[model samples]
Target chain A: MQAFDHHTPQTLPEALALLAQHDGTARVIAGGTDLMLYMKSGKAEPETIVNIKKLQPLQGISATNAGDLRLGALVTLRELTRSPLVLESYPSVAHAAGFMASEQIRSFATVGGNLCNASPSADLAPPLIARSASAHIVSADGEREIPLEDFFRGPGESALHAGELLQAINIPPPKGNAVYIKHAPRAFMDIAVVGVAARLELAAGRCRTASILLGAVAPTPLRARQAEAALAGQSLTDDIIANAARIASEECAPIDDIRGSAWYRRRMVGVLTRRALTALSNAQPLHAR
Target chain B: MAKILVSLSVNGDPHELYLDTRRTLLDVLRDELGLLGTHRGCDAGDCGACTVHVDGLPMTSCLLLAADYHGAQITTVEGVLDDGKPNSLQQALVEKGGIQCGFCTPGFVMNGLALLSEKPRPTEAETRAWLSGNLCRCTGYVKIVDAVMTAARQSP
Candidate 1:
């Protein structure tokens, strides 16, 4: 790895000031899982690295009085999965957290780093978007909140400005049960070929609202508006699910990569979408493997 | 880049060393501290051969900067011994024919101890999921699974 100056800040203000001074030439590290890889591979060469692990504000997972779940930026994936509040209240979040990486990686991979990495196949974004999670970002100037949906600008790009620190992600309690499924050759440690998350609000045995998102099938994790629209105000029967899944598969634009072919991904998106809906209707936790 | 002063405890021993900012915990351990039990295989995080415990949490030492973990407690494979002897997990692997290329043994033993410490008797599914990252190219992982299962049964 190329050499760089490293600083550990014990407060958010100190971190912000250091980042501001270095500006575009510095990188802030929460968990070094991904950043270390980039550095070792010579893909990233920031003159300075500000380690925020010492900052107290960025190291917790809690629930607010308003029934919102707050996950600090430094909360590792293992912490998320092991939290009783998350496991009981947000099964989708727990499943996605556990599904994305191996136990070792989870111990070191942070939620904020995962979001800030901005991979198209991000396991948390679709579920967080489905749950209406928002990111809390802080800079020397002040703090702001951006809906998780708008947080991503493109692959490896985020809306965060220079010197901005991601404090925590706040999630409104979900309306109903949820499911997140990833299609991959291995159950763990592999990137998603087609990741799908479904959050449904049901009343009177009919769908009141549905949020469907597809990952790794587009440049950005996207909401399948056509499929969401199809499932709205309709009973999820076999016919309805098939139509919705078909629309979802058709909606995404996938690429041909070593992981899979575009045609296979497109087809699997439909299959996984249909399966997710089927599981939701059956009230079963979905697992592809 | 200039050298940075880093302090960390390894195997109940504390040491402060001045190392280049680029020196990873793995390199610092093997070269600076001379704890050679932690293998350096696949410097990338792909292989868990360099697995070590940072505050009781297993991490790929090669991926971690020693400076980032200043004042932290780290336990490499060598530190996992009990009373200067291999622990129950290591004993099981030996009795169950789990060793072939011995190169990955340190990592496997470290990861096994980690899993058993968290859950004395992890279900087969749980064991498989937790240990999936530490790949052993030889043995096809059958004897490893058996060894870990045996250790779980023998553990208190």
Candidate 2:
């Protein structure tokens, strides 16, 4: 780690001012788990390290009376794993949180950090994107919101502009069944080879709507648009699920690395998609159950 | 080098020190504080040999910056002593042959304390998952699992 000045901002305005003061040379830390690694690797050399853990605006897990879940940027992933609200409302999100890193890492890692890091293998992106969650950003000027599906720009990049910080991610109550499955070499503390998220509304043995997202198979966690189109309005029979799985396998472009080969990841994408849909079809979601 | 003032409570003792932002909590404990109980096996967050408790949550001390831990309550391996005696987890590990080379014992005891804090009695699966971060090469996990089970039995 390089020697640098540290600032603990108590308010959103103060945090924004600190970010503006450092311009692009500053980095914001919520949990500082991945930030320290990046700094040690010389990939990030920030003159100012802004700690936002004290900010009141980014510190809770509460939902609105209108049924929207607003997860603060600083809310630890471990909190999400055990939050009764999350388990009762969104089990897939909770399960994904558990599947991420070890208990030690999850105890300090934040949901916003996971999204902002923009790792292709990040577990939260596919579920949040499948739910069509929206992100709220804060800057010196004001606040703005964008869909979580469009939040990641590329590997280790986010859609945030200079001096803008992600405040919270807003998610609406599920109108359909959603599931997330992670394929890893180890049971815990392993990055996924392929992660698949699916949300489908079923009606009279037919799929009324669908949203299928794939992770770790591309530069960004991407929505399998064509495969989603294939599942939409189609009955979730074995043949239909198999076809959608095939389309998903063809849709994603993966790279060969230490975890797995490109061909294996592409193949696992199809397997996980089928598995998630089959699991969703076999049992009712936790909320519905 | 930039210097920052950090206030930390280690083992219930408050210390105010001026430190570089680059220095991690693990370095502060070992070098400046002279508390050698915590071992630094891997600077990266993988090995978990520097596992410590921050605000009742177990985390890798190597991953935390001293500056970022202002006003934080930290518990190192040296801090888990109860009345100058080994805690139940440590005793059970000693009785159950959990230590061979003893390099990873502190980490295991710290992680075990975290598990016991949450649930006095946990299932075998839960105990295994909670200690997944800490790695030991000398004695493969059979005796360590027995130690955790014994500790749970003694406490619960």
Candidate 3:
């Protein structure tokens, strides 16, 4: 790894000030699970590292006044997996957190770093996007909120400014059931070939609203609008689900990669989407098995 | 070039060290503290050979910086046994033929100890999930899983 100055800031304001002072020359380190690897691989080489692990404000999980869930930027994936609120209200989020890299990595990988890494194959992005989450970002000037949908610009890219820090992720309480399913060649310690998250709000045996997000099949975590539209206000019959899944496959622009081929990912996207919708329609947890 | 003063408790002993800010917990353990029992198989977080207990939870020491864990309690594989007596998991591994090349044994033992500490009697699936992070390229993981199950059953 490259040599760099390091500052352990005790406060968020101090961290933000250091980031602002260094601007593009400094990078914030939370868990360093992803950032250290990036630095070792020569993908990232910042002149200074502002360690924010001690910034107390960027920790914990809580409910917002709007009945939404707010997860601190530094909240580890393990905490997400074990949080009672996440387990009960957002099972999909918890399931996604549970299926991340491994127990060891999960203990150190933060939710904010996972989102900020902005990988299309990011495990947390699909579920959070499916739940219509928003990101709370803080900068030296002020703070701003960005919807999860608008947060990702491309793979390994986000809308965060140079000196801005992601404070937390606010996921609105789901009005319906949600499920996340990922297809990895191997079950553990592997990246997803095709991941899908489905949120279904059913009323009187009909789908009132739905949000379907696809990962590892696009430049960014993307919503399958056509598939979601197909399910809205309609009963999720076998045929309807199949059609929606097909539409989701069509919406994805996957590319051939080491993990999987574009064709295989497209095929699995359909399969996983159908499975996710079927599971969410029945109000079953994806990882229950 | 920047070094930070990190105070941490390791294996029931408190020690302070001045290490580079970028030094990982794994490096600090092996290089600085001479805790070589924690193997460094994969520098990246994929492999859990560098697993250690940080505040009673198993974490990949390779992925965490030593500076981030100020005043944290870390337990490595060397701390699993008591008074030279092997922990139940360690004893079970030997009896169940779980020891193969032995390179991955420390990690497997530590992870098993962690699981058993949390769930005294873990189901087979739970055992599998707990060991998912620690990869064993030898013995096909059958004996390892069996050893953990046997150890959990033996737990009081």
Candidate 4:
């Protein structure tokens, strides 16, 4: 690892100031799980590290006045998996959190870092997007909220400015059932080949709204808008679900990687999408192994 | 980078030392504190060979900067010993023949001890899920799971 100045800021303003003073050369580290890997590999060599672990505002999990699930930036993946509120309200999010790397890594890996890192295969991205979540970003200038779907610009890139800090992620109260399926060779400590999340709002045995999101098959978590449109206001029959799955598989832009080939990922996306829809249609239990 | 003075409690011992900013907690434990029981496998977080209890939760020490955990309570593999003797988990591992190369033992012990402390009698599936982070290439992990199960049963 490269040598750098470490700054433990007690306040978010102080942390933002350090980032601004460094002029985009400083990095904010909470868990340092992903940042440490990047630093060790020389992929990231920040001149200053703004440690935000001490900032109180970036901690805890709560519900907004409007019943939205508000997860602070520093809330670790372990906390997400254990929070009863999260498990009850957003089982898909909890499942995705627990389905990540490993027990040790999840013990310290934060939700903010997970989204800010902007990995296409990030477990939290697809579920949050499917739930219509938004990100709250703060800086010395002030704070602003943006749709979570717009947060990811590319791989390892986010909408955050140089000095901006991700405050929290807010998801509206559950209006539908959401399921996230990660297609990976190993159940634990492995990245996904193709991940799919389906959120459906059904009324009178017909779908009123559908949100379909795919991961690791694009530069960012891609929402299959066309597939979602196909499911809208339609009966979720086996044939209809299969048609929507075919449409989703055709729309994502996957690449050949060591984990899997693009062809395999595309095929798995179809299979996983069909499974997710089938599970949701049957009103099966949220827990999926 | 310049060295910074950091204070942390390791194995119930408090100490302050001047360390470079790049030195990880694993380096501080193995090189600075001379606690060699915490092995360093993958410098990355993939391998849990450098696992330790940071404030009672198992974390990969190699990825943690010592400076970042100034006032943290750290429990290494050595810290779990009862009066300089192997604890129930260690004894169970030995009796169950869970050791082969022994490189991944300290990590497995640290991780398993934390799990056992939380859930004294975790099921086989729970044990497998909790220890998934620590990889033991040898013994095929059968004896390890058995050892944890035995320790859970023997724990008071």
Candidate 5:
């Protein structure tokens, strides 16, 4: 890896101040899984690294007063996977966390790092976007909340400013069942070729509301708004689900990469979208399961 | 660049050292402490060759900064064996044909050990998922899975 100075900050304010002082020359290191790889590959050559691992306040899983799930920026994927609240209330998010890298990588890869890294193929994005999650960003000025949907700008990019630090992700309790599914060449540690996250609020055997997010098939994790519109106020029948999946597949603009071809990814999007809907159809309350 | 003081416990032994701020846990283990069992293959996090147990959970040591891990406990492949004797997983791997070229064996062993720590008797699917990150280009993973299963059965 390239040589760089490292600073371990004990507080978020301290970390943000360091970032501000360094004028974005410093990269905040949480898990360092993605950042370290970038540094090693010469993709990132920051002058300094501000380590936020020592900040205890930015850790844990909790429910806020607004009934939203609050996840600290430094909360590792392993912790998220093991959190009963996440598994029970937001199985899609938990499942997405579980499917990330592996048990070992999950132990250190933080959700904040995953989001800030802003890789189009990031496993956490689709799930969070489907759940209508929001990001809590802290900078030298103060904190601001941004919906996860508005967070990503493009590949390897995010809405975070130069000195802003992503504090936590707030996931509003889903109104209905949610499921995250991905089609990777292999089950573990591989990036998704096409990943889908579906949230459906069903009432009296009819879909009252829905949100479908697609990943690895676009510049960023994108909400399949057209497909979501097709599912609203309709029963998830074979034709309806198939049509919705088709719309989702059509909405995505995937690019060919080493992980998969664009054609393969588009095909998998349809397959995964259908599967996610099917899974959501049969899904029971997490506690009962 | 000034070296930072890092105090950490490795395999039950506490040690203090001064290291460059950019040094990774993998570097500290192999270069500073001379614990070369933590093989450094694919310095990137893609490969689990440099996996080690940090605070009882398996993590990619290459992704961790040594200075930031002050007071953290790390267990490497060398720590998995008992007094130079191969652990049950290691023995099972030998018996089950899990070892071929042996470059990836240590990582597999460490990952297997970490898995059993979490799930004492993991199902076949669970075992496969746990060892998925540790790549074994030589054995094709058939024997590695068998070895973990056999080891679990042999334990207790």
Candidate 6:
């Protein structure tokens, strides 16, 4: 990496102050998996690195009083996968976390860093978006929250300002069965070609609500609103699921990349979306299963 | 630039040094501390050649800034040895013919030792998945997986 002043701040306020003092020339280092590589390649050459790893407030995984999952910004992917609350209540999140880079990378790669890096193929984005998660951002001035879907502006771009930091991700209580499927050549250590996440709330054998999100095929993890509309209030039959999947495939604007061709990603999106919905439809009721 | 003071315990030894903040833990281990067991393969964290246990969990040390790991417990492949002797996993790897080029051995040892510590009894598929990050370019994965399984079976 390039030569830079590394600041390990013990408190979030101290970290925020350091960031503010540096103006726009500093970058916050979370896991540093991507940042270090970028710095080495000169893709990102910040004058200062604010290490927030020691901030205690951004390091917990707990359920709020209302039963929503509150995941701190610094929670590693391994911790997310192993959290009882995540594995039980948000299996899709755990599944996504489990499918990321590898055991070594997962040990330190933070969910916050993954989102802030804003990789189009980030595994956690689709699942968290499907669960209607929100980003809790903290700044020296104050704090603000926004829907996770709005957090990404493009590949490697986020809604965060120069001085703001993502503090935590708040996931509301799940109301249905969910699944996150990542299509990669290898089961591990490979980025996704086409990632899909689906959550369906069923009542009286009809779909009461549907949330479908796609990754790797768009500038950001995209909510397939058209496909979701097709599933809402409709019985998730083979034909409806297939139609929704087809619509989802068309909704994304994928680019031909090394992992896969745009055509291949589009085709895989339909297949994976159908697979996710079919599996969710066949699964037992949320509480029972 | 002024060097930052970093204090940490590595391989059961405590060290305090003033080092350039740009140096990674992998660089510090290999160059400053003379811990050559932790090899540097892809420095970009793609190859787990520099895998080490930071605070009891396997992590890619190549990406960790040495200055950020103050007061942390770091365990490299050398640290996993059983009183200067090969641990069960190391012994099993040798017996199972898991060594070809031997360049990836330290990473495999660190990662395998972690797996054995977490799950003493792991299935073949589990073993394969756990060692997925540490790539043996020789593609001698079957014996590596076998060695990890053998070590688990031989334990207790």
Shift in Å, residue A213, candidate 4: 0.5
Please report how far candidate 4 places residue A286 from its true position, in Å: 4.9
Local distance difference test scores for all models = 0.88, 0.89, 0.89, 0.92, 0.87, 0.91
Could you tell me the fnat of model 5?
0.75
Interface RMSD of each: 1.1, 1.0, 1.2, 1.0, 1.5, 1.1
Q: A17-40 in candidate 2: lDDT tens per residue?
A: 989877878899888888999998
Candidate 3 lDDT tens digits, A1-289: 8888888899889999999999879988898888899888999998898889888888999998999989999999999989999998888889888888887788788999999999999989998998889999998899999898999999999999899999999988778888888888777788888889998999999999999999999999999999999988898899999999999999999999999999999999999899988887877766662
Error of 5 at A185 (Å): 0.9
Estimate the lDDT of model 4: 0.92
Q: Cα lDDT for residue A138, model 2?
A: 94
Question: Each candidate's root-mean-square deviation in Å?
Answer: 1.4, 1.5, 1.5, 1.0, 2.0, 1.6
Report the error of model 2 at residue A5, Å.
Answer: 1.1
Query: Which CAPRI tier for candidate 3?
Result: medium
Q: In candidate 4, what are the lDDT values of residues A1-289, reduced to their tens digit?
A: 6789988988777888887788788898899999988888999988788888999988999988998989999999999999998998899999999989889999999999999999999999999999999999998888899999999999999999988999999999897899998889899999989999999999999999999999999999999999999999999999999999999999999999999999999999899999999899888945743
lDDT by residue (tens digit), candidate 5, A1-289: 5667878887778888899999878888888888887887898988788889888768999999999999999999999889999988887788888888988889989999999989998899998988889999989988899899999999999999999988889998778888778788687888888888888989999999999999999999989999999999998898999999999999999999898899988888888888888777666532232
* Candidate 2 local Cα displacement, residue A44, angstroms: 1.2
The A-chain TM-scores of all the candidates are 0.97, 0.97, 0.97, 0.98, 0.96, 0.97
Chain A TM-score from candidate 3:
0.97
Error of 2 at B2 (Å): 0.4
Scoring each candidate complex against the real one, what DockQ results? 0.76, 0.81, 0.74, 0.81, 0.70, 0.80
For model 5 the local lDDT of residue B46 reads: 71
Candidate 6 wrongly placed segments (more than 4 Å): A284-289
Lowest lDDT 10-residue stretch of candidate 5 chain B: B39-48
Query: 1 or 3: which has the higher TM-score?
Result: 1
Candidate 6 lDDT over B42-119, as tens digits, reads: 888878889999999999899998888999999998788787899999999999999898989899999999999999
Q: Residues B1-156, candidate 2: write the lDDT tens digits.
A: 999899999999999998988899999999989999999997888877899999999998988888888999999998988789998889989999999999889988998899898988989898888888888998888899899989998874
In model 3, where do residues sit more than 4 Å from their true spots? Answer: none
Kindly list the per-residue Cα lDDT of model 1 for residues A1-289, writing each as its tens digit.
7779999988889999998898878898877888999998889987888989999998888989998999999999999888988888788888898976677788889999999999999999898899989999999889999899999888899998888989999999878778898889998888999999988888888889998988999888889999999999999899999999999999999999989999999999999999998898777767422
